[model samples]
Target: MPESCRSRELPASLLTNPEMVRACRARDFARVFRLVKVYAGIYPSMIARRCELTPSRVGEVMSGRRQLQHMDVIERIADGLRIPGHMLGLARRTWETPLALATDGRTTPQSVASDPVAPASLPGAEVDSILTLTSRTDPSPSMLQALRSSIEDYWRRDDQHGGEALRPAVLGQLRYVVGLLKENRPAAIRHGLYGVAAELARLTGWTYFDALQYNQARAYFTEALQLSKEIDDRQFMANVLACMSLQATYQEKPADALALVNAAQDEARAAPGTTPRVLSMLSLREAFAHASLGNRYATHASIGEAHRHFDQIQRGDTDPAWVTYFDEPKLIVDTGIAHGRLGEAATAEPLIAEALRRENSTNQRGRAFHAFWLARTQLGLGKLDQACQTATDALEPAASVASERVAGHLREFYDELAPHREEPVATAFESRLRVALPMRVSGSPRP
Candidate 1:
């Protein structure tokens, strides 16, 4: 091997470097190329040859004139440069988890059987890639259990701080789980692996959705549906469809959203494991679609149906891990959101306020989101001072979260308050926005 491309193995120190870590996490290959030159003596030419990219294209990426997005290209880069797959949101590379020896420095059969994964591959809050952990090697029940725990932790963190930083890690885990699905397994293990992949895909879709990247969101949601369908997990399929419907709702496609919810309610209900919480969520989504379309009566009917389902909840009923977040507080919040969307601010105001009081304050994004809705509800009822105050209170929580969706809601409320811009309350809110959400709030009104 030429010295410039010398064996492709990056120094372990370089891999653990903070700058390189951030660049890899963000998939900022331009910076990665620069860092490689500084640390590993690999120039752009050698990179092009090793990664199978033309010199010109490599220069373009290194110069930040282009970005690499395709998964296949990413995989190639991971293999060629010897970057750990998890670093680039790909599956773990073959060389990463070599089954070389046991803790005692001997290749014991029992050790390989018991410890198929390196400690680095353990699933945690970071959702690290674990190809050697849950793949064809062992696929133990504990491995799957740990992944589920990691996913649940992700959900908690996402609710609290928003998911912008979580995207890469989640995708890495998702890729690893998808790789696990390729090997033949027992029926139960296959089913379980598919479910985990679907959940991860759904989560990736949500992070994209929260960032307002609807196209990327829809693609992941579709992938989630496909994975769920592969296992005939109708309930999970319904969940993924509902996620797509929510994206459509946000995109202002009420009809499309309605069609998705209708399919979920009609077909997914037949799944043996379907829970009342699932039905309640589907009904709420239907209400959102109807409310968005200004179908007031239909919206009310859907909300009523949602409540009917919510009341069916029993302590012993088996609910999927993902859907457990749709508890009473969230249900109330969604119903209030539906009413607010339908322009029934008076009805929404108290409901939103009560739900907020009941909601977990640790969930910063949720607090900020519901606060925006509550402000809108108050504004609709002609309570200008109250609305502004509510919006002002939301800024702290919103600042803690990194969600474009929350920022959009704040901007939306500001836009609606434009007519009353001259009022002292609106002006006060605008000043606060300029300070708290400097990027979201222009110093002046939108042109």
Candidate 2:
């Protein structure tokens, strides 16, 4: 086949999507065909031609009038769609041969999944750009900027949905960026590359953290800190420390969390690039630590300090790109979350509800996270019916959000409702939970 025809592969984002993966796993080729068209732009005629089926047959499958059951036909579909064999519960495809497992032939779905920086996952330009960066000693400014923008794009997708699907692409990008560091480049280019590498590592850590993979998250976070130090980027180091502190809090190590935050604050103080948003973010981390430890007075104090820093924000203040998400809605939500952590239901409930209303509509993960928190707070107030109602409302969005952290929150709410599981409201919510978040609800381990 011509390279163009052979290079035809599904988009990494689509294949890694939880819904698409589930649909494929269940051999729901009808849904798979629909999602492929939506996400990969492979229309029915194209799918028919590629998969060796009549367009009418493709239409039938997509319309649920037919199913692809024959092993031979299934293999054809797998090879045509470039879907991993494992996803469809089949042996590895013939195209994914041992030689094809090489770094050069990253066309294999496993490679596209584990390390996604290939023609399959990236655009021609991006593939060319990364190859240039890795294969040569010096890379162009434009290429560097393109890579930096891709990092920004990753964060945007992660915020709206969740980081689970983005992990492969990000880790691949991280590896490529880190590889660039070994090559000799101009001082400015090298410095910029370090920044990209640091941020990518941080993002990798965050993705692992979202999935509750603490050890992996910490390793990447620590690497991010070291990479920041390579460029003497103290501000980035501080940010990494803050991220570590947040993860520690989630790990139930509040004392460790507080110490990390203090170290982060010290780094921020030393770095002249620190902005109010950065300070506010660090202070919020401090608040989370105090709250987790049930230090009510200290939690309130740190949150107040966070607010003070937040109030100093001004337009065009030149805050780091990473801290841009620390806007009003975030601060408000964190305050409520801290209150909820301390079991202050009355104060937490209204604040979290209002914050949810003000949250960015595209942030599905945020919506699910806050809704779970609100449900927990309501449960604490003995409003079992209201709690179950809130959770029921959240179930749909939770299905779309692949955050294990959010799933853990859902599990927490379920465990909290255990005592009243026989209650009608709780029973109804339980049924909904089974449908929406079955795997997480069952206490299954994160992959």
Candidate 3:
């Protein structure tokens, strides 16, 4: 490992290096590895960590013994190394791609849409390329219905199989939706398309977030927020913001999470008839942010506010599909999570237990998370044996699912149990957990 490449980011020495850019653009992993070595500033160990590969695997890729073929691994490399997705046969990078400067010389944030026939950024026949690939016909009611049905199916599958299992399909659906947006259509259909597209984007974002892919998640959420804003869909915007806030909360940016939830609440309030349930969900996220900050009073107040709103939700009331999932069971689990974060384990225990019981078998991810929390609460209450048993139970369902969030909580539970390793029960639990959830190295590496 190169000593100079200790930091995750590219050292200043390689930031403006042309060889780095050329290798990246060509999607040449071996060439990129060679250039890093030649530059004498990047380490194979660091690359291994960034790409979620072992040092030996990194060496294999560099030595032409292994190929970077899987889309997931390719995405990791592109994202880790800041390679443009277009360079690797992808529609667009998961993170923001720099736009060609507008006529005013300011970098444009919006996609180039002035000439729908051909976007300004496309250098060649890519316009015709995707259209041909998608092979979409003119927009129609049936097409819209098909798209909505697909989104619903993907959402249902996500709830059952977790994000990592459904991310690719959701991403593909999103790309197809984007292609439809380019076609000329009636105002109503176009608006509907945008609405569903926004939902799809949000759903994809959530899946990425569940997998702990923060950059991709944030980018998709940003796209959803922008689409909702274009249609003045304040309610949808609030939901997207709430999702972003939740991600921030989990990422340990409590202040930023609070700010985001505040913005979401404001937006929800402005919507024509935002449902009480929707507002309650946002309020719950606010409580979560407060709990993360160790603000007991604020957290309790927010929890109360959330319950009040939740109580006002009438059955059979019209609501978007997304907020409909914020039923009593969800509220209980979220409240338990907030209280648990505040170290009120006794207060959290029963609620988490009840939520675990109430969650459907299809919701394996939720069950795993709630089960882990129940164990954590047990630990906090000094019920060491119960905690160990509950944590062991949590791992089975979690192992069957593909959610990084569940994996993360399980890892935290393990860390909390570290001091008890000498105990036989703790030792057995640790042994099982290590097999179920191996620890990833801790550090964020930007390319």
- The candidate with the higher lDDT, 1 or 2, is 1
Q: Residue 371's C-alpha lDDT in candidate 1?
A: 98
| Model 2 Cα lDDT, one tens digit per residue, 7-52 | 4678889989999987875568899999998988788877876776
Q: What's the lDDT of the predicted structure labeled candidate 3?
A: 0.78
Worst 10 residues of 3 by lDDT: 112-121
What lDDT does the true structure give each of the candidates? 0.84, 0.82, 0.78
Clashes of each: 0, 0, 0
Off by over 4 Å in 3: 1-136, 434-447
| Candidate 1 local lDDT, 116-167, one digit each (tens) | 2223322332232242233235577888899899999999999988887887
Please identify model 2 stretches exceeding 4 Å from their true place.
1-137, 441-447
Q: What tens-digit string does per-residue lDDT give for candidate 3 at 1-447?
A: 543334334454564576765565435688887776667445686666555556666776798765454467777776665455644435466453355432446665554222112222322344434543564468788888888888888877777778665665566566566657776889988898898889989998998899898987898899999988878999999999999999998899999999999999999999998999998999999999999999999999999999999999887778888787888999999999999999899899999988888887787777888998899899989999999999888877887777888878877777788778799999888777666655432332100
lDDT of 1 at 395: 96
Better of 1 and 3 by TM-score: 1
Estimate the TM-score for candidate 3: 0.70
Candidate 2 pairs with clashing backbones = none
lDDT score at residue 282, model 1, on the 0-100 scale: 94
Instruction: Please give me the total number of clashing residue pairs in predicted model 3.
Output: 0
